[model samples]
Target: MTSRPGGRSARVREAVLDAVYAELIHRGYLGMTVENVADRAGVHKTTVYRRWGTVDVLIADALDHTRETDWPVPDTGTIEGDLTAIATEIADTFTDPERRQVPAAIVAAALQSTRALQAKQAFYTARHTEAAKVVTRAVERGELPPQTDPLELVRLTCAPLYYRIFVSGEPVDRTTAERAVQSALAAARTGLL
Candidate 1:
């Protein structure tokens, strides 16, 4: 669906996605409903159903919409600074009670629906692509080897954070973010990533 910026359709989409986000955080994928989103968005239920067709599809679209506001590559002068910034950005999300639920729900939804899976993949792909630019800059600065894999470094940096929250059920804190930065930096320096 095409929504011109600042148009009524854009406003409606924004409202629906806002409601979807809140529902994902509070109700999760299985519990989130189009009716609930419509109610929260103050729109007719048929509007959401007609546009997205299913809860999973609506959730996917909502998640996809988040990319515009999500992860940004830091332009700090050093690779260490950039990695730390990136890790901190991720850590902050996991540490925030409200923000954390979104990722958790997305992961859970991906396991159950193809649309959610695609959304999850697209979300990370965009994030990784943006974050990889930091490493690409570092390579140009001679901080990393010319052959360094930017996305590999990006993935390594994020892997532990994801594992900590999703698998180990551990708290994601500033220290956790720092450790990931250290590990990924070491790996990048050693050409291990």
Candidate 2:
């Protein structure tokens, strides 16, 4: 639809994305269908077929869009603060009822499908790209070693939170998030990164 201003196409796209997200959250990736999404979005099935053509592409598009809107990296002054903010954001993502299930489903879908996996990787790559700035800021401030790998550090910082959700299935809270921040900070301070 090109995202042009004041267009019904944009509205329809938004509705389709909204329907896609709701379906992913409530029914999961496998349960998601173009017919169901079209019905949910109040559009014709042919419209969905003509626009996206498949559930895989629609799920990937919806996921990529969510990553653009959500998962913003915080620019708190210190590395610890930044890491803490990142961890908190991750925790909130897992715990927030409005968001929790869909991501879990997306992650699972990523494990099952190449298309979903590429979309997940792209979303994480973009998130880490923004988050890398925090590590760069820390290095610039002399808080980190000059050779620190920003994206690697960002991955380490997020891994625990993802583990909690995708592996342990444990509840993530502020305290859990803080522990992850502290652990990463400790390792970082020791030049382990």
Candidate 3:
């Protein structure tokens, strides 16, 4: 059957994804269920079951929907400014209590489910590709070598913040964000990245 972009199916998908995100944020992966999601979405259990089948699929679909959403890449006219903006965005996100739960839940779900893991990987891959535009611009402007890997630079700028937040349990503020940007930029400038 042919699909309409803004028809009933689209509306149902959006509602279900929104409900999944809310469920993940409030109840997390462990507490969330397919019935709860369907009820929260105002849809029948069978509809959700036929479309999503399971909580992991629901969460993965939510992540995929989120990945497809528009994310404005920073354009500050300088690599440092752009990368700092990117890193700062990450810091701000995880530092917030409610917003942090979404990704934390994604990570937790990924550990237990291959579907969630693939979704998480695809989400980051899309984000990295989009964020790498700044590094590409930097190369164009002669700020970095043409051989520099934009994805690597983007990954480097984001790695330390994730490490601190998920591993070392350290605080990540604007200072930490800027530091990560600087280190990544330095590595790129030195032909290390």
Q: Count the backbone clashes (under 3 Å) in each candidate.
A: 0, 0, 0
Candidate 3 lDDT by residue in tens digits, 1-193: 5476888999899999999988877887678999999999999999999988988888888999999999999999999999999999889988887788788888877887899999999999999999999999999999999999999999999999999988999999999999999999899999877
Error of 3 at 61 (Å): 0.5
Please say which candidate is ahead in lDDT: 1 or 2: 1
**Overall local distance difference test of candidate 3:** 0.91
Runs of candidate 1 with Cα error greater than 4 angstroms are: 1-8, 26-31, 68-71
Answer with 1 or 2, whichever has the higher TM-score. Answer: 1
* TM-score, predicted candidate 1 vs. hidden true structure: 0.89
Which pairs, if any, clash in model 3?
none
Question: Which residue pairs in candidate 1 have backbone atoms (N, alpha carbon, C) closer than 3 angstroms, thus clashing?
Answer: none
Each model's Cα RMSD: 2.7, 2.7, 2.2
| lDDT (Cα atoms) of all candidates against the true structure | 0.86, 0.83, 0.91
Model 2 / residue 104 / CA error / Å: 1.0
- Candidate 3 at residue 48, lDDT? 98
Deviation in Å, model 1, residue 183 alpha carbon: 1.0
Model 2: how far residue 10 lies from native, Å: 4.5
* Runs off by more than 4 Å, candidate 2: 1-3, 6-11, 26-31, 67-71
Every model's TM-score: 0.89, 0.86, 0.92
Error of 1 at 41 (Å): 1.0
Number of the top TM-score candidate = 3
